[model samples]
Target: MLEPEHGLIRQVEHAHTKCWVCVLSCLLLASVYVGSLYVWRSSLPRDHPSVIKRRCASVLLVSALSPAAVKAWIHWADIRVDVSVWELMGVRLEGFVPALILPLLLTMVFYLGPLVHSAMDDPDGFTTELQSVLDVQSWRLCVRDVVWLRNQVVAPVTEELVFRGGMLPMLVPCAGPTAAIFVAPLFFGVAHLHHIIEQQRLQRDGMSVILLVAGMQFLYTTVFGAFTAFIFMRTGHIVGPVLCHSFCNSQGLPDIGFALQHRERTALLFSYLMGALLFLVLLFPLTDPFFYGAIPVCSLAPAPEPVC
Candidate 1:
């Protein structure tokens, strides 16, 4: 078999234009995610499932739209580079399992852990507030509708294209992995800062809450972005971190500050164990070489030198 570097280089060279197109397509998809919500809000039914479906549809729409948008946009916008349908399928398909399945497993384990904690206090107030924040029927309903759409579909697609596909590749060769990981999330946080601002402005009926909700959302999303960036570096696939992130977010896990303070306690050990296990689900492929081999991602080799 030919060396992998031979294939990697050809892959990069052939797909370079499509890569840029993916990055640009993210911006368009984000607009769609936000815009569709605004345009359809009044028309959407107030029932839990309907509300959740519309929101989830928006997210899935963004995920599904990125590649198609990129293909059309690149064909018209960049005449210098050519991209084949196979390459498009390769990139998107490479993303599917990690983006979808892994997160679901992690969330299941994460919630189950808390349920086992005898001292684990249910935040009914937070739960009620969260349901209102999502404008959905129930927690389970929101999970099926909003989270499945946003994290699994929209967030992974848009975020991976911008960070791993666009920003990381541009910086990794020049600044190396450490720098790329750090820098990428800073920009990712910046990209989604508007979410924080929007959440703060949201007032549902008479339930006026403090501005902390916005701050929390910003902090949470940024933290998620940082973790996702690291996963992409470790696994050489944007899918890994995207799965890791969606899992972490959907479970409504506590922040690092709380996790650390409780790290040494035995009573709270189950929660930590569950959270750790959830994190491991995202790392499954990396830990299992056989599984890694099954996925179509860039090799973990240093970039091959250009032939003179």
Candidate 2:
């Protein structure tokens, strides 16, 4: 019964409402994330057991809170919350494996040259380091690294829940899938800038180094956010991005120092880089939803009627 102009106005208002919800949800989550870190750092010794427990609790609290808040907002706004956890968190083989592997493979390729050079140049040292990593005692220390815990497991779950699971669906109503994919990641990228503040507090690094490091982090995290958003949209599940994030954190970034020093290593690095590029070129086709038979990602709003 509504006229065309009235319908357009309604759509605009709906989009604006959804956008506001997404922004406010992200802001609330970011505040909790950074605030918890500051509080823990201030209250306890850096390595204290209480700090670890508190960090885990804070992450869990915020992760749980964000989704609940979103659901409540949706219901209160008279919007349907039809997205399921399975749709948000399911792990199908086709979608999950590639999602997990591609980033890891790219990371390995990035480090391939340096790793090969290290093995050849200092075989004993390399073997010793490998052995140490594999050693039970070393694993115990790794388990104790709160930062590792946060990055590998906690952050993946909570961030995916907040950003991909919560925010992206809300965004789909307002922005469509393409815009949602790109826009939600901006918040993700900004959320990570808090790392710079944390680093400055802990390290007495010169301003130049701090700024450079922070800049690179912001760039990479933003790019990775976009990538994760894409994966979430394609696979229609939070699990895809969560696994990818965890694997990425485990692999960390490649150290290319050896490639700079040796010609052979340089060639190897170039080859790996080329391979990574090829993989990226193929990423979309390989991850197509039809190929995976993934559940269709439900939108937050009903689609408009088609015109004759």
Candidate 3:
């Protein structure tokens, strides 16, 4: 085989250097983000409106400034992609609706049985639930409620912007789409560890219990992070991840045990299996980048994989 060109070898060396910087910058970003919540000297529980609002302010600022991470990336003289941070962060207008709709719809399909169960458990009855959907007062109350707004909108948007939008751009160019999906989420997972501090402060649980819960949370969030990262890579747009994040926050995790114990176990079990099967079956097809238009970020991939 012929020797590689000197310029090609030097370019590869520069890319390696940039990847190292990305790794460090991502860790620093996660540290500052998680650190922000504790900066307030509040004695109140995390769920307290005042505390929630302050933390919200802290995180949103971090997200708004997250583009700075890209500046760190381009510090390497000849290695950077010369793309805007917003576009690198998957903020393009192409494939807007499908990015908004299909991934969230796919997640809901995975939670079909649990969501139906949740709706069925609404004691106010279907009519009341329907009315509530159309109720301006209810909408206003949700808007006014800091916790509701944080959960349904602010957290999802900010977290996705930071973990997916901000972090993925740095990581994709370095690790490529497949590896970045798994790698970037570890920061997302570790950033969630701050929850243990709040729970411990409240004395709501013993040390062991808090640690155990935090560990489990880390696992779950990391797995979810990978899924959102996967969606981000495939669509190369932040909208899908944000919508899916918001829906998952609203639904919580699927209550597999509750479904197992329900009176309609037969039908519910069928749904549980079928929904999962369908989700797995459609995961690739529904998320095809061709359907969403050309994904700009796939340029960072080492090779053109199907999802990209």
Q: Identify the candidate with maximal TM-score.
A: 3
* Residues 1-308, model 2: lDDT tens digits: 66998999998897677667756766676677657766664634445667766877887887777756666656645566555434533334545655565544544544455566667678998898889866999778878878777778888998887777767766666666777778888878877777677567777687789888888887888888887787777666567678778867865665666456665765767755765676667666655666445444444434631100
User: By the TM-score metric, which is better: model 1 or model 2?
Assistant: 2
- Provide the lDDT at 48 for model 3: 93
Per-residue CA lDDT of model 1 for 98-137, tens digit only, reads: 4445434544455555544423455675566545766746
Q: Global lDDT for candidate 1? A: 0.50
TM-score (all chains, Cα) for each model: 0.51, 0.76, 0.92
The residue ranges of model 1 lying beyond 4 angstroms of the native Cα positions read: 1-29, 41-51, 72-180, 183-211, 232-246, 255-265, 269-291, 294-308
Residue pairs with backbone overlap in model 1: none
Predictions in order: lDDT: 0.50, 0.67, 0.84
Give the local distance difference test score of model 3: 0.84
Residue 272's lDDT within candidate 3 is 80
Candidate 3: lDDT of 300? Answer: 64
Task: Indicate the worst ten consecutive residues by lDDT in candidate 3.
Answer: 74-83
Q: Could you tell which candidate, 2 or 3, scores higher by lDDT?
A: 3
> On a 0 to 100 scale, what is the lDDT of residue 90 in model 2?
35
Error of 1 at 228 (Å): 2.9
